[model samples]
Target: MAEQTQVHREQAGINAAAVRSAETAESTQQRLPRCRKLLFQFEVDMYAKIKTERLSFIRHNQTRLRADDYIYLHDAVADDRNANRLGNMVILPSSFTSCPRYMHERTQDAMTYVRHYCRPDLFITFTCNSKWDEISNELLPGQQSYDRHDVVARVFHLKLKQLMDYITTGAIFGAVRCHIYTIEWQKRGLPNAHILTWLWFHVPSTGSMWPAKQWFTLHERRFPIHARHPTVQHLSVHLENGQRVYFTEANLQQQLQEPRDTTLTAFFKLCTLDDFARTLLYCQLPAYYTFDASTKCWKRRVQGSSVPDHPGIYQTDALARVYTVHPNNRECFFLRIILHHVVGPVSFHHLRTVEGHVCATFHETCRRLGLLKDDAQWREALEEAATVRSPA
Candidate 1:
């Protein structure tokens, strides 16, 4: 159901992008070379026809609904009060992604949040500028942002998650009590987010305190927006044409001295010894323990952190985060799901071993534990039925 919701969200975005009027497309300079403007226009036209056909098909074939003579009914008769009436209509429910009902429910949810937390302190508008270096870097030859909106959309989604993580984790404007956002496409065909954030403490003006430029700028004092443990130097390097370079500790021992007493190793060791450590999931370690590279061990955190909503109680969240796993990868995906419950397994074989019986694969193990709540009963029934049936 969660996966279906995700799929619905993605399709909603794609459909919205697809059916948007080509007339609303931003005009580039008359002199500038056109890439796939005609292709985009064609896609728009096709999407419109597809949508109309789909609605018509649904109207005919789908369950027509009406209230007495208007909703959830297969057929309806004209009422005495009102003579003018059509057949029972196929209504778009709240589950229809960005339909009127869905949008209304979403708005109501935001209103409920506002009522709970009061008016938002920060009103941030995050624009997905196609000019971002990340987007430019990924574009193939002869391709523009408009040409590959999937890529643009994905990059925006990832960056939006990062931005939200920063805000919610109190990296900016302290902690946020609650946040609600809506994404809309501008007249320029660029997507932008209108975010309303309610901070924990009252602020006179957030803009004056933390300027937009500072949020974007990669200052020396701020944490670098680079990947952690990134390679200091590339293997294929041109020898200096009188270009002076110093040999540092990183140059000598970067590859060599990857210490054995890292977080994972220490976690495994601690799991064997410490009862408290054994209770923790893999990602929950950061809530109680901090990794010390110099000391080469996991140190217990004396002071725990709190979130905006749960200020009184210590939370395992925010201290660590795991990357989202796409459900398509069968073995890897199932293994990741299982690891949420079974943690600090010393080896891969140990991970596979559940309840003293080592399963052949993660899927079998998941079935054994009833993990992911898959249709195991139906699967088993099919296997049993296949044996009983004779070959045709």
Candidate 2:
């Protein structure tokens, strides 16, 4: 009886080795090619769309900037109000630089608020770090350094769209209001922004001022915009000869009317969902592509077809191979569902090369729900069972 038990243990070790070897082989076969393919395709597509849309807009024959255009631009400014004073103002952390694409939108928002609320004074403040003094000295004469002037300008331009949308919509819930602030703090390795707002609302004669804690809690729940990451970059246009080039909106428009670049057009075509998916498939499968519990259905992406409702085994091992490469690849899964129809038009939404760490965590979470089998070894058995028939 002891000899038989030893024999069983030896057999189990052999089976484990074989399973590990098979998993490794399968993983290697699916990973490398998928990563290279997906990333290359996405970059090509994104470049094309930007070039086409941006360049084309520059060419249109609109000579006169209208009142509506100014209103659109004004909406980008932040809002500040004091109790009973009913003034609207915009503020930013004093390190912003530039954004050309959204100038009009910012102008519109600011103008709209001023017109409606009777031109509230703009209060610009700076959140200066200790390093500002050292950086200011190094700046060329007449150059704007990391001071309040530069920061406010950049913040106003960078977040024009969001600022305008909030104020015009009349969604003001809290007493004090804040707007966008763009800051650069890379020198200290903590570069980013924090939007600070102060709210003041009317109080009747009998009512007392609300406590700071209550005010902050309400502010957090209602006006929750704060500093985070920088979303856009400001680039300068230069001539092929390495000289700085300046062109007015009229000049850019004139150039656009003449001819369009074919290369730009082709680039956008490549960034579509199909191209992105194809690239991702070359790298890896999703780590955990299972049915969402809240949604109560398994998600699948098919070319040119809407995702179908069905029960399917979670392909965890297959997904793990791809996710081992890039963690951001998981976002592709969510994008695949939302942009199913426009996969070919969108460039950045593919999940084929995500890193396995995040994928594994997601897979384990799904496992708890019984969507995935506990052991990969059971895959073959599951496949075999699918083909077997029970005697009637």
Which candidate should be chosen as best, given lDDT against the real structure? 1
TM-score of 1: 0.38
Which regions of candidate 2 fall more than 4 Å away from where they truly are? 1-53, 56-101, 111-174, 177-191, 194-198, 201-392
Runs in model 1 with CA error above 4 Å?
A: 1-35, 61-90, 142-147, 202-392
TM-score of each: 0.38, 0.18
lDDT of 2 at 119: 32
lDDT of 2 by residue, 172-230 (tens): 43333333333444553333443433234432333232222211110111121223111
Q: lDDT for every model? A: 0.52, 0.30
* 1-392 per-residue lDDT for model 1 (tens digits): 36445545555765666545332233643212243676666765766665665455445433322212112111222123321233334466565556787775555455444434556687888889898876776566677787756456656766765777767763467666667677777887777787777777753324433234422222112121112110111111111111112122223222123323434455666777766667678766666566665775766655656535533434432233333234565665566556667866665566678789998987788877876476654464364334334221
